[model samples]
Target: MSTELVSLDASKLAELIRTREVSPVEVVQAHLERIDAVDRRINAIVTVADDAIEAAKAAEAAVMAGRELGPLHGVPFTAKDAIDTAGVMTQRGSPIFKGRVPDTDATTVVRMKKAGGILLAKTNHPEFSFWIETDNLLSGRTLNPWNPDRTPGGSSGGESAAIAAGMSPIGLATDVAISIRGPAALTGVVGLKATHGRIPMTGIWPRVPRRFWHVGPIARSVRDVALAYSLLAGPDGADGFSTAPLQLDAGVGSSPGRPLRVGWLVDAFAPVDADVAATVRASAEALTSLGIAAEPVRIPVLEEINALELLWKLQVMETKPAFRKVTAGHEDKIFKHVQGVYDTPDTSIADFVDAEQKAEQLRDGFAAYFQRYDALICPVTTVPAHEHDAAEFDIDGQKVSSLHVMTATAPLSVTGLPGLSLRFGTSREGLPIGVQLVSPWMAESTILHLASLLEAVSPVRGLHPDMSRI
Candidate 1:
């Protein structure tokens, strides 16, 4: 019964709770028990909220009293460790902030609680949430649920692994490059990087290069992500970038009045695995069967955009100085990856200015492409979940730079566009393969609508890891 309850998506769980078919305490206990049973293998959860059961008891009382409930009433969810949670440990996967707990919840955490979602636990991440894999001195590492030897992808890998393993139904995650989407792709879940700043970044760490950072949801379904986005978006009076409102009532359905047009690209990023490319092509073909016009298109600007260079510049020029100031006296405690940021050559003001100008041009180029297509479909990464321990790997028998993992994602990050990653198929080794859906700046609804259409035809839907093996 606990396994069945944990397998249900957040929307279904909320429905059962609202109908009195299940109690809030039952839901919370089921997830907590699942975490205890499975988390030792993956190490995804860094801190389990001690007051979760008490909160669940209060929620049960509210339900028994027949009080009005929020959309996610009694549903349990987790947040990445980098996001502030009042009275809950948020170590940021770095020893420097060990045992740290915030006095107040992040704006997103407050909104999630307001919507009646119980905070069950905090998940792992790379130190300072700075790397693409979930490993740090603080919490060790978060392994892929599909294959214990492989990574779940990071910096939101722990949240992805937890959701994939059915320890949580939905979660809060942040993405500067591919933190949210990459991990979701590797773990066979739904990750939405809403239009940058659609969700507030008020309580997240490393507030530098604010333009590329995004707060979003990771769930098991498109509808669940859409629901969380509606609850978590909008200006919080603190994050200036979140001032613009989202079109909550826009066109978001599997069947629209007019057939949608989608552009598909497999080699947008170099050296894509043949299996990964095939899966993306299969997704595009599947969309055509749903009466959507799926065609091939290319944006040469994708080649022109240098994602790693921009990220390095942001790290050296903006994030490093600010982060160093905060961890001044405890330099030795910082993660080696983060400490390396300080050793990087300082970026000149002129170079930083030029990079910003190039980023604007890239955004404009994508905007112009969107004028011709309703949405763009591409691979989330070059390959499926790879084994940990190496910085570089081979793709299609060719040795490539390790940064290829974020190549396809970083361009969209720089543009501040909305990007969604959904499970479409699996690799030859049975690992999940995801395709990315990207739309113009504020057109998140378009991507969600298309994702819903694709989900209905996805071969990987309803397939989950066998947690008993863990």
Candidate 2:
């Protein structure tokens, strides 16, 4: 077997496995062996499924018996610790849920399993899925596969790291506020945070009061993201919040049959690093190459969305009891910055109502902006991947937490619009940097279509970190 098995795209692997050109067992074993060899260095995987091999064996039997295959048939994948998996320890990277096991798979997990995806393992996350860096009491920290000392981006950090290192072909991740996209940007992967509730958030940890929370996929390519999205999307009777399926096409770029008008938000309510700005600009430039018109537009209201200080406070107020038990004398051990959010008082009813109204207004404004442009181009983060333990950092002279610094990412979250994080290029320091492609609500296919074209023009898919480089 070649050591390069991990380098192949998930779609190619699934096709070969479905056609009997490669056995599912062989594919699973190759990834398992790769995990054994590389996971120690990155600490991305937590609990490897005990029956993974057996699961692969069974999947192989189905293939041999001429069973119809799903798009992702026989492909191996992993999920963030925040998503519940039946019979597996979903520790949530905290000592509180250490042995907690769900009797039923999460809505997304069950769908993926039914689609012929083998559950390989569970990846790491911040305690309670709270931070942009994946570290907690139970599982330690998940290091960036590119630069071990730098962060992999969280709470889907582990999912991003694992996929970047080739431990899994595709990863199931969550994105409350760039948790999926940020990690994808930092780790050189493709992550899509579809419109709110497009994928059910049932069984995910830290159930916040707001619908800003989203579950998405982090994968090696755009097609893999589409396949994962197709399986994970649609209405699950268990989740009533999931909106009726919009007429959204999430596949590759199709001829929109009209001239594409794109709104480029260069300064997305936050000061971006020089290299980060350049990376996004280059991507916008690439779009123009294909006859797409790019117009600079300002989203001033974007700054208001990142003032989530009050939002986090309300979340803490609601989940105080559950979090207290999880922290049990370990409050100091948790990320100090994260714990501080809870230290603030809860959002008063008046404040909550005011924010909701304001948020709706912001959504209306963006919808109007989208009326003029097919998509919005912006930065995913103010900077590229920071040091692994980066809690506080200086961005354009403002001292901010990793969470607040990602103001560029919050507008889409607050507006409940779909955003795709596309790896554009690396920083001068050789760290991965990506651009955010935003489309109107439920227009995931439109954003993805533009992303596919950008990806084809200036493909940054070449920079996967070989953790074994050392």
Candidate 3:
């Protein structure tokens, strides 16, 4: 029964709870027990919230009283540690802030609670969310549930691992580059990097590249991702970028009232694995069965501006300084990957200004592409999850850097557009391979609608790792 309870997505769980077939307390307890049973093998969730049951009990009372319920009413959600939770430890997977706790919930967290979602726990992340993998001096390391020898991807890895392991149904994750989407792809789940600033980052850390930081949902199902996004995207008045008075509509089952065109590209930003490339192509062809125009696409600015390198250069200036300020005296407590941040060469004033200009060109390039196609499909990573701490990978006889994991994703971050990660294929090694669906800025509805359609045709839909092996 506990196994079945945890396997249910937030959407189905809420439906059951709302109908009184299940209670909020049962949902919360099932997750807590799942955590105790599975987290030891993966080290995904680092801090479990003590007040989770109390909050669930309150939600039950409201439901029994015949009061109004939100879409996610009585559901439980976990969050990446970088997101602040009032009174819950938000150490950011670093020993530098060993016992740090926040005084208020992040705008997203508060919104989730208002929607009747209970805060379940805090998941692991890389030190300050700066590295390519999720591990820290504080929480040890997080292993991929699909293959224990592989990584679950970094930054938002633990959030993905927890959901994939059936510990939590849906959770909050932020992306600076590929944090949210990359991890979700590696774990065979769904992740969304909403239009930059669509969701506020009021109580999150490492806001160095403020324009690149995006907060959204990671869930096991596409509908759960849509439900979370609908309940959370809005201006909270505290974040400067989130001040846009935009009303979001998730067009899941319905397409725009006109013909839809999509373009798929796999070899854009890096040398991708053959399997990964094939997945992107297959996803595009699947969209055609729905009467949409799907074809091969190439946006030149991707290689010319080189968003992956540009993002690294910009971060060397912004993220490095902020990291140094916090790790000043506790440098010894930091992980080697984070310590390497300081070793990065500083970006010169001229190059920094040039990267900023190139960012505009990248955005202009995508704007032109969208003029012809409603959405774009591409590989989320060059390959599936790599072996943990493995240095590099061989892609079609060429040696590729591990940094290529974020190459396909950093482009959207540069353009401040929306990207969704959903599993559409599996690797020869039986790991999940995901195709990214991207849309122009604030066109989240189009991407969601397309992802919903693709989800119906996904070859690996509803597949998960064998938890008994873990």
Candidate 4:
């Protein structure tokens, strides 16, 4: 198998398999080889299923027998450990539920398989999917494929790292705050956190019932993300709040003639690093190269965007009960990190109600903002991926806490807007920086259209870390 085959977009790969140019088994084997070669240094994959060979063989036989092929045909994809996979240990990065296995597949997983995506394995994540860095008592820490010392942002960090390292072209990941997009930025891959309720959140760990939680795809290209989105979207019936089938627009490469009305902003609730600012500026300049109307705009202070803190607090309120159920006889297995917040008091009903209303107001503010532009360009995180064990860092020469460090992404999460995070460039120290393009709620097509336009002018899909270990 050619190495170039591994880099083919999910669509192209599926077409090739459908045309019988490459068998499903061959494609799966190539990715499995890559994973075996590189996954150790990065530790991105948590568990590589032993029966992948049998599954791929079966897919190949179906194709050889002239059976109908799915959209993703022979493509291989991984899922974050937090996503429940039938018969696979869905350890949510915590030792408390170390050997926990699910008897049923998540709705998204079932859809992906039905669409012809082959599950390669499960990826790494932080304990309880809580931290920004991927680490836990079970799988250890997941390192950036580019620079092992730096982090691959979590809780989707492991998935990002694997794709960046060429272990998998696409992966299933979830987002509450910046888990999906943040890791995509840090690992130099394409990560999409679709508008809340756009994709069902069924069978995900640390499950939050609110609309703030979203599940989407992480891939090497925007088109791959779109393909995954199409396959994984729609109401699962179990998730009563999920939206109906989303109408996917033509892929980003569909139209290059029309210019995009791009809104550029850097000061998004927090400071942006010089490297990130340069990349965004250069990206906008590149958009202008493509006849795009790249306009500079100030981000409006959406009403009570800070209410994200409150929502996040409330989401974790269930953590105690959930953990208590798991750690019933063994509290010692629970990691002490972030215990202060969990052990603290719960939010009052009055405070929770006020926060929810404020969150709605923030969404309305973003609605007004999106009405003026096709999409808004912003930083995924204030800084590039930091050291693996970093607890805090200096921002603008002043020490800042980790929670405050990532305030830029919270507003979008609060508004439940669609955000597409693409790897833009590297920082001064050579760590990857992620820049995000956000659109109004349920406007994933617009978000992806702009991302594809940006990628065409300044291609980020081809950029990957040199994983010599592979």
Q: Which segments of model 3 are wrong by more than 4 Å?
A: 248-256
Displacement of residue 155 (Cα, Å) in model 3 is: 0.6
* Candidate 2 overall lDDT versus native: 0.81
Off by over 4 Å in 4: 248-260, 302-308, 338-340, 343-345, 348-350, 459-461
Q: What's the lDDT for candidate 1?
A: 0.89
RMSD (CA, Å), each prediction? 1.5, 2.3, 1.4, 2.6
Kindly provide the TM-score of model 4 when superposed on the true structure, using C-alpha atoms: 0.93
Model 2 C-alpha lDDT per residue in residues 245-321, reported as the tens digit of each score: 74565323466567877878767555677888888778888888788877678866664454355445445556666
Report clash pairs, candidate 3. Answer: none
TM-score of each: 0.97, 0.94, 0.98, 0.93
Q: Could you tell which candidate, 2 or 3, scores higher by TM-score? A: 3
lDDT of prediction 3:
0.89
Ranking by TM-score: 3, 1, 2, 4
The residue-by-residue lDDT of candidate 3 on 1-470, one tens digit each, is 77889999999999999999999999999999999998999999989999999999999999999999988898999999999999999998888888999999999999998988999999999988877789889998999999989999988999999999999999999898889899999999999999988999999998878878899999988899988988888899889999655565333235447787789887676688988998988998899877877999888888677898888888788888788888889878979887787888899999999998998999999988988888899989889999988788888898977897888999988878899999999999999999899987788888888898889988888898898887
lDDT preference between candidates 1 and 2, better one: 1
Candidate 2's TM-score reads: 0.94
